[model samples]
Target: MSAVPGTVQTVGLFAGQHVLAELEGVDPALLDDEPFLRRTLAEVLDLAGATVCDVISKQFEPQGVTVLALLSESHASVHTYPERGALFVDVFTCGTRAKPERAVELLTEALRPTSAQVQTINRGEAEAPADGHREGAS
Candidate 1:
């Protein structure tokens, strides 16, 4: 039998932040439409210089509620729940700080909200954390 591969730990440096933005009271249809949601999501990730790793979505019947999650290594994701008109967005990027800000702007434009809130958490070399804590959050 071949030997099992061991975990590799690499340390990279950069300056950026982990941003989490949430919007409340959004129309479910906005998320129910797959094409529109996917397009917008892809655009946001592209702006952050991130690649789309995977996506998981769930839609409810009758109520027309939907939840979408876009996972990425660039440290960002867009989560949406249409039924409740709510959206939860998280962006974590290293080596690039402006990406997250642009992501927030792009999302806000794509997803128009009655009242939207944005919160930015500074991350990067200043906040270099150890291993075993969290991935894509260095």
Candidate 2:
């Protein structure tokens, strides 16, 4: 929605997908490998139709790893808990340039989680108020 001359746009116009995944029984060693995680994340981004601009991964001293991919459309990330044999993943992309679900799928394959729970959300779907009133405004 476009802003009128004197009124403000009370909602967003862009459409994006956000995928949240909870993984269990993952391989602890895989979650601690920075290089492997980075490469795998890059491949996942490519498979999801996202252009990867850059990637950052970190490994904790005791255990676990975190990988973040900065995509042209948006960002994808993974946080691992090797001790718990679990991980949390988030993939968000704007427009139709990428598929967040595909990314999560690939991650599930690479991590080999025994059980997984995924939640997908459609962002920026609210209709803008013609009267220029926000959602909570009376």
Candidate 3:
């Protein structure tokens, strides 16, 4: 069946996760530690309405950390450094409208940051396929 005229196409629905945060007073050792990063990633995923399937983390000497989480519907991640008082995070959910920004909010609150900054961006919407291109391509 052909799509009704003027109706919005359902080729690929839009959704994504991305946020940058600045935090203060955290222990660099803890933040840059793999175990800590994994625990934090799990909590963040739960709070973001996503289920974490697996987590991989890497630590940089002195003070830097990165974590990647593979989730059921999507993924959530973070990079942290207590020495620099900074954290970068990303949460991506595909085909669902689950809001991952709340995770950032929770983290900001948990860290009890004296000063912080947050930036969020949606990553996949603009690339949604046009109706004509979607109709028979699938």
Clashing pairs in 3: 17-91
lDDT per model, in order?
0.66, 0.88, 0.70
Model 1 local distance difference test score: 0.66
Candidate 2 lDDT by residue in tens digits, 85-131 = 89999999987768999999988998899999999999975555798
The parts of candidate 2 lying over 4 Å away from their true place are 1-13, 126-138
Tens digit of per-residue lDDT, candidate 3, span 8-104: 6664456565665666666566676688678876886687677778988888876688888897767777788667766766666765545567777
True-vs-predicted CA distance for residue 93, candidate 2, Å? 0.1
What order do candidates take by TM-score, descending? Answer: 2, 3, 1
TM-score of 1: 0.64
Runs with alpha carbons beyond 4 Å of true place in candidate 1? 1-11, 53-56, 60-73, 127-138
Candidate 3 at residue 2, lDDT? 34
TM-score: the better of candidates 2 and 3: 2
Residue-level lDDT tens digits of model 1 in 17-121: 777888876677885666676677767777756666665555455534333434444555556666678878777776553377777778887878877888888
